[model samples]
Target chain A: MIEVHEIVKKYGENNIVLNIEQLYIPKGQCFGLVGNNGAGKTTLFSLLLDLIQPTTGRIVSNNIQVNLSEEWKPFTSAYIDESFLIGYLTPEEYFYFIGELRGWKQNEVDEFIGGFQDFFNGEILGRKKYIRDLSKGNAKKTGIIAALIGNPQIIILDEPFANLDPTTQFRLKFILRKLLENKETTVLISSHDLQHIVEVSERIVVLDRGCIVKDIQKSEETMQELESFFKDKISLT
Target chain B: MIRLLQFEWKAFLRSASYNTHLFIKIILALAALYLVILFFSLGFGLYFILEEQGMKPFDVVNRVLIYYICIDLVIRYFLQKMPVMNIRPFMIVNLKKNTVINFAITKTLFSFFNLVHIFFLIPFSIVLINKGFNLSGVFSWCICILVLIYINNYLNLLANNQDVFLYGLISVVCIGGLSEYFGLLDISRYTSPIFYNMYTGKGSLIVLFLIIVGLHYVVFRFYKKNFFLDGGLSIRTRSVHAGDYSWLNRFGTTGIFLKNDIKLLSRNKRSRSTLLISVLFTLYGLLFFSDGLEVYENPTLHIFAGIFVSGGFLFTFGQFVPSWDSAYYPLLMSQNIQYRDYLNSKWWLIVIATGISTVISSFYIFFGWDAYVAVLTGAIYNIGINAHLVLMGGAFIKTPIDLSKNKNIFGDKQAFNIKTLLLSLPKLVLPIVLFAIGQNIFNSTTGYLMVAGTGILGFTLKQRVFKQIEKIYQKEKYKTLKAYKAQNNF
Candidate 1:
């Protein structure tokens, strides 16, 4: 479980992004964080990962405070941006390096990464091509697969489907479902594609500017209501 | 065409504001140039004083002008940038080929070193004409200086454009060997009448000027034809995982950092070239060391000689360590790692580099085993003193350096503040002062032993000093970062 209490982030003198009160994310649930551009989705993600310090807040996970525990780091995996991908190494080498960092044996790393051979359509593994040379969609696929390598309890993906092709997008959705079913991995995904977010996520949270505007769970009539609500809100803007 | 020149000038000046240090350096360069002119005038005044005592002024002035022209040729060759700057932009433009070529040739005139022809040669020409030398003589020498400058500029551009360094080693060997062989045969003198006549005073200045002009035209024509061709900037695509190093696992983070550091250093042309040049200079000193009375008379000069010989490793190795990670420093900082480990890794790298250099330099110790031992002693002192100094300097002196740009070894833009100078002064002056003190305190053998003992102690204690410095680095990280960013515009 992840808990954020009174998180506030400021750039210079202005509090451009903020989190009021408290929020909790239970284990084994898919949470879709939907926000428009400049809506603090990335900043919030950065804060959770401890990449940047929050102006004022307490973040806790699994009875351990966020900044004080190595447990939080080991169980959490994030791909914030393309910069997260080390460009100098081939996909295979990069995967192996990340696996080693997680203390995985060579045989284990190779075996696990080898499972993605078919997923990549035989384009990535053992190709001896740097990540910088890979196309945007392929690079994203590489990042996602690497994050899943150690089977972390929580995976945070930012804009995972933005640059992917339609076929790849469908495949990724299926892969996420399978991972959820098997490992009960709690996934937090941020996206602007409302239709896809609603389809994949069990709980949807709407963020406008920096504050959480609405939180809803998917139900029998919730999808229809969400579609109408989203349309009204966008039209009002 | 004039508008294009104006645009180029505006763009250049606008880019200068990108870094405050770079803007200050440009101003400093202008002041330095003015000082050089003032020094030259003072030397001319001294010559006038000497010439009044029955020595011929024309001969002295002529020799001075010739020497200046030679130095100008070398300086122009190294500093000229017109060929690359002009040709690159013209490659994709709709401008006519001849027009582009004409611009490139004319741009050579804008180089500051070309002004030497006007300053030195023209003034000397007036003196020669007043002294009743033939007008042809004055004109010939002036034209010769101009032709020499152009020849040097064009040759340097051609060589650099063609990736000449790839073939440079072989070319040097071949030329050296051929010159020696021809000198032995005694028939080499007949092969080129120009060289023979130049030595014998039969060479006309017109013939020399015409030959250089023809060579310039040929080179210009070649560049004009291939200016837009993609031969020069071809990116080498390679298989990324060509070699896998399983050994990296054994050493952990240090191994990873070292491997990555080496890769970054090797991939960057500027950094790698600087390292190579430092090694080459070490070898030059080793090859040139001589035991002479003139050099050893002053204890200060002796210690200075020792420091200069071993100082290259410290000066270049630690100078750009932080800047090498400028692009990805934020990422590195975010990782759960200690600042001490980062500094320790840098210290070890300097030790390794300095060790290799000292081994190479030991071969040229001319004063027998004593000189070799002194060099070894000095090398240890340099490692301890200079390495600590660099870390201490890094803690306080915050100057952001762009790793991508090539910086001269003694460039004015490098952080040469009072703080850095004070930090460096102890490294340079203390060893000499110690050696002098040791010499007075004991017999020659015991004095040498004292100096060597102190060096060993310093080397051994370097780690302890580095740890203290690293603590300071951690505490002052934000201040250092702020100062670093403040020095740069972006």
Candidate 2:
């Protein structure tokens, strides 16, 4: 579980990017975040990961202040972009490196990656290619899978499905569903795909500009409501 | 064609880093101006020096031309980036592919490597004419030299990434130098006549001209065949066998970091070049020791050489510490590792490399006990004090390095900026100045002890230094992450 209190991220004077007064992500929840371009989705994720300092406020991950102490790092993991992947390392090397950092033995790491054979599509491993040489979708798959290593309690992914193929997207959704089956794992995923967001997450939060506009428990008509809300915003412009 | 050039000009002027690029360019131009002045003086004075030796000045110059071309090729290989055409944007427009390729090839003719010739050749030709050589002969020879220089320029572009061309030329040069040294074969006897024939108004001028034209067409055709967006613009990827450094995992987190650092050095082009430069630096003491043991007694220059001899890796790789991982820094920060452990691993890596360098530099002991001691103490100083200074310097660095870019000496502009220049004062100068203070008050033995003492103190206080550096790193964490995210597209 994570608690964000009075988090305000500003670029300069008169430009507030993210200004969330209070946001809580409960344990074992499949939390989905939706936002348009420049809606501060990535900024919010960066603040939670402590990649950037909040102009005013703090983020607490599992009761540990992320900025003040590093105790939160062991239990939390995130893959926000290509910057998460080391370019020179092969996908296998990157996975093993991260696994080693999280205290997984080499054989254990190998056995863990073996479960993702279908997700890898046979193109990621045994290809003698570095992660940098892999295609964008494949690279994204590598980052997402690497973050799943070591069984972290909190996993964050930004735009996880953007560059993925349809098959891998479905596989990732299945993976998330299986992860949420446990009562302690909290998975936070941000996406632009509304349909996938509705199916994969039980709780969907919509952000417009810097404010959370809608926090709805998924229901039979949740998709229709989200579609109509975005349509009205477009027409108003 | 003119519009294509205009597009290139606009892109350059509108770029976000234009001011920084312009500043670096100005500095490079000033440094170049100094080199040109030195070359001009050498060329102008060459005829007089040869005359005093009772040798024919023109003949000697002709013989040396082959050596010049060989050296020029090596320098060009390192300094010249592949000429960028930005052809991707223009590919969709209404234009002939030939026109674009032709424009790219023609643009390469104005490269600094080609134009820098005028600085040396023009002065040499002026001296020949003043010395009363045949005017027409001098004219033909100068034109031939210029043509050969262009020939080298095109040959370099054709062989830019070919290891065969680079290594073959190096071996050939080494063999030729050795042969000349041992009196096996005199290359000048063969070269002097071939070039001297041009000065005798022979028809070799036509041959040289044809060779240059042939090379130009070959380069043009090569670029044409590989003009696709992904083919010519991207760094070529070769499948490399994964190396196993799992033996290092026994040391725990620092070992894991060291393993990753080794992969980084071996796999990236830019980082691999630093390894090559460090290997070269191990022999740097040769410059001081070659003058013999008596001249090597100058303690100041000995310390300078000793620093280079022992701290080769510290100076080249240490300066780029966290920037080496700038691409994946956020991943590092978000991971479960401690900051002190990260810095400790880097410190260990440097200490291990300096240990190797110091062992190799024990060859300097052949000079004298004093010479090796100077190197030994310098290594201690590097391990104890300068390692921390270098990491502290890295704490202030916010630039992200493109690890794959191998050409263009100024491509890694972070290597030459004002911050590094200011940091080098403490990293390089302070040790010698500290030793001088001790030596002036007592003996050279006291100075050496003083330098080693400071290193020992720093060695013992590693945790305290890391605590302070960790604070600085924590403060700059977000700012550095922002910079890397902004500039690092690779």
Candidate 3:
């Protein structure tokens, strides 16, 4: 479970990028955060990862206060940006490094990531090339696979499908669906792709400017309703 | 063509203009060069007026050619080699490579140092000719000097293309060895006949010109063929193991910091090079002080100088602590790390480094027990003093350094800021003052023992000094960040 209570973040005087009040993500649910560019999605993710400090209020994850502590960090995995991937290391090396950080043995890491090998079509694991050399889709795959390697209780992904091809995006959706069926892992993904969000996420939150303007659950409404709602909100603005 | 030149000039000036620091640097460079030229020109003018009574016509003509050749070579080498400009970006445009190369080569001709060569050489040559030396003799010497200058420049370019320091050492050794061999064997006497005609004024001027031109062509051809965007050293890509040093688990934060320091030093080329050079320089004292104190009758002065030289490693390595982390400082600050732990890591790193240097210097200590004791005292004093000084200086100093950019050992850009210099003053003065006061108070052995004892005391009190510095760092954290960004013009 993740709770963001009245978080406020500012760059300088009067330049508040995020102003939000009370957002609770229940355990074992897929939450899709949708926003246009510069709608504070990345800022919120950064705060969640403890990459930056919030100006006010607090974030609590799994009963532990969200801080830059090893305990809180181990249970959470996030791919906020490309820089999260250490560009110098190969996919296999990065996976092992992340595993070691989470105190997982080599066999454990191999076993965990080995499951995603079929999905990657034999392109990712054990490739001796650096992440910088990998194509955009393959790099995203590498990041996603590593994040999922530790089997963290909570996972956050920012624009996971941004640079991926259609085929890879479809494969990723399939993987997420499988993850959702487990009912133990909580996933928060922020993306602009409404179609994919509608398909994978159980709960959808639409953010405009720096505020969450709409929240809809899949069980609460049909897919067409949410689509129409998003269209109407965008046109009204 | 003129428009292209204007565009290039605009770009260079604009880049320079962005940073007030770089603009100051350019002005300082120009001023320094101007002063050097003025001094040399004054000396030459005095020599001509008083000794030679002005230059002869032939000497003037010969000197002009020599001057041009030397100036051209130096300018060409600098223009082609300095990676600062990175003219590779121009290659992707509609501009031809030849045109760009031509522009670059032409820019070399405008150097003030090159102009200085012309001023001094031309006047000196004229005076020599006026003093009744034969035209051929004057011309031969001038042409030889010209060729020598080109040879020097080309050699430097070749060395710059390779590792600068490694090739510089090789070149110095080669020149020293060759000079010694020639002096001993009189090999020049045997080869004199080959150049006898040229020296005697019978050889053609066209031949000399052709030779110089051919050398220039060769340099250009070599550079043109091999000089791609990434032609020099192959970039090494290493697999970084996260949490690789589990041994640090014992010391907790200190251990983690030490491990990170080790990883950083190993991964970054500048830090690694600085560490390597520190070791090398510490050992260099051995070569100088090998003979023992009796070699210099006054053991006190010799020991003092030895002590100063022995402390070289710490001073050089400690000076750049803050600059090393400039690039990743934001990430470092954002992490929930204690200020004391960060400073302690640096302190420990210096201790480890100084310890290694002290052990190496122990070899020289074997020559005499007194020398051993003196060096040990100096090393210990430096370690204690520098640990405090570096931490304090790091807190106050706000210079941000990009370790990725290749900098010279004595580059002005990397040299003393007010904070560093001010911090260094006490380190310098304290050692000398301590040594002096000790020498006045007691016998040499007793004084040496006291110095050594005080150094030990300092080492014990280092943690307190470190804590004080850490408090200062915490207090001025934001200011330091601002300073760092300001210094680098980030």
Candidate 4:
């Protein structure tokens, strides 16, 4: 479970990137965060990850204060972008590295990665080039796969579908669905693609301009509501 | 062409760390020019110095000519980058590949390095002319030397671009140096006559000319093949090997960081070059050990020698510290790794590196048993005291290194803080002073024991020192991460 209490993230003077009063997501919940650019989705994740200190209040992940203790790090895995990747390493090397960090045996890592053959589509596995040399989409796959390595209880992915091909995107949905089958698992995903988020998440939260604009449970007409809300708001801006 | 050159000049000057401080860049440029002038004067006086040192007048210039060329080739091999045609935009446009290739080769032709030989050969030739040598023989020899300089330039490019040529260059240089050192063949004496023959032998001058032309043709062809397709679109042969440093696992969390740091140092170009420079430094004996035994008698000299001898590579490499990982520092900071384990892994890595370097440098014992003792004590203090001092100093560093680049290695822009300079200073000076006082008060054995004793004290205090370093690192973590992310000029 993760909780944000009266959290305020500031950038210099008069610039508040995030100002969330209270947020709580219990374990096994697939929490979807939808936002446009500069919607403070990343800022909130960064705060929860303890990458930046909050201007006010605190974030507690699994009842452990994020800033004060590192208990959340063992269970949390995030791949926000290429910065998460050691670009000099090959995808396979990077995967094994991640597995090693999480204390998985090499054999177990190889077997787990083998399961993604269909997902990989032969573009990423056993590739000769380093992650830096790979195409953007392939590089994204590398990072995403690295994040999913080991038995991380909480998964955080930012813009997962951005650089993925249509097939991979379709495959990623099934992956998320399978991951969510474990009731004790917590997944926090942020995306501009409301459709995929709506399909995968049990609850969806919309963020706009450092404020949570909408928090609604996913239902039959969730996609339609999200569309109308974004259309009306984004057009006005 | 002028416009293109102007645009390139602007791009080069504007984008480079030239923007950091104009005063710094100006000082750097002057320093570079000063080095060239100093080396040129050395070349200019080399023959006379050899004569003074009691070599025959004629054989003096001839003996050193080959060594000078070899040193020049070696320096250029490590330093010069191939002039790449920035042709990505032009590739999709109405440009011929040959035009771009020709422009690139021409750009290389005009580099300061191409004219550096003038600094060496021209002055020597002027002196030869002034020393009542025959004009035609002197002219013919000058022509031969100038032709070889051109050959060195073109062949240097050949070595740069082709893997076979590059490896061949490295092997030739390494094997040649080793062979000369072991007295397998006197390379200087064997090659000396070739230049000496150029004075009277029209045959030798003709041969040198042919070789220069042949090398130019070969180098041109190699460049053509590389830039031939799509105007050098960078179609490189990529290969990846799986590295398993899993044996490093028993240390728990520290093992994980050690594995990553090893991969980081081995896999990346910048880091690999750092390792190579460190390895090359194992030859510090050839420089320092060349001194007389009298220098070894000074207790302080032993400490200085130990600093360089034992920790030659690590001392230089460790100062950069966590900044070398500035590329993925945020990822590291986000991971489950403790600051203690992170710094410890770096410490152990430097210790291991210093151990290996010390072993290789153990050959210094050939100088004397005293040299050997100094090296051992130095290694102890270096690994124990110096490593911690550097780690503690590194805690204050916020200048993130661009590990993704091998663009400008010699720009040597280390942000050495007062804390770093002051702390690491005692690693060298303190050992010397301690050894001196101990020797004066008691005897030489006590002094050696005191140096080792100081190292033991530092080693025992490591945990306490590490705690303070950990606090500093955590306190400055955000500022360090911010600085790292700001290095975006890939």
> Which candidate gets the maximum lDDT versus the true structure?
2
Docking level for model 4: medium
lDDT of each candidate versus the true structure? 0.65, 0.86, 0.65, 0.78
TM-score of chain B of each: 0.73, 0.91, 0.71, 0.87
Fraction of true A-B contacts recovered by candidate 3? 0.02
Whose DockQ is higher: candidate 1's or candidate 4's?
A: 4
Q: Model 4, range A29-93, lDDT digits (tens) per residue?
A: 99999988998998888777887889999999988999998878889998887788887788887
The deviation in Å at residue B105 for candidate 1 is 8.3
The segments of candidate 1 whose C-alpha lies over 4 angstroms from its true place after superposition are: A1-5, A15-37, A45-78, A81-97, A105-107, A118-210, A213-237, B1-27, B30-138, B151-250, B284-288, B291-297, B301-308, B335-340, B392-422, B443-490
Give the candidate order by descending TM-score.
2, 4, 1, 3
Deviation (Å) of B17 in candidate 1: 5.7
- The Cα error of candidate 1 at residue A24, in Å, is 4.4
Q: By DockQ, is 3 or 4 better?
A: 4
Q: Model 4 scores what on Cα lDDT?
A: 0.78
Report residue A30 deviation for candidate 3 (angstroms): 4.7
Q: On residues B1-490, what C-alpha lDDT tens digit does candidate 4 reach at each position?
A: 6655876799778764556655556676897788779768966786687678887666777776776676676666666767763655555566666776667667777777667677766777777777778788988998888777777788777665344554566677677777888989777778888888899789988898889878767866776776545434464534766666778888777777788778778766667667777776666645556574555555557657766777865766687788877777767777766788789889999999989988888788887777778778888888778898888777666667766545444424545445666877797789888888888899867888899899989999999989988988888887787777777434
lDDT of 4 at A168: 93
Task: Write candidate 3's Cα lDDT for B1-490 as tens digits.
Answer: 6866787678677763335455457666787778777746753574555446555433334333433443444334333344325566676888777766666555544544344555555666676677677777767755665554545454445445344545345454445446645776433344344344444654544575677677667756656665465543224344544446676657656765676567566655456556656765665555445653365545455445445555655666566666567654533453335567777777777777777777777777566776667677777777766567866876665656555444544323435455667787876566656666777887676666666676778788977887788778666665655555554543
Docking quality level of the chain pair in candidate 3: incorrect
Per-residue lDDT of model 2, residues B3-104, tens digit only: 989977997787645656566778777888888787788778888989999998887788878888898887787777667546677776899988988887
Candidate 2 deviant stretches above 4 angstroms: B21-26, B49-56, B182-189, B292-297, B408-411, B438-443
DockQ of each: 0.24, 0.88, 0.17, 0.57
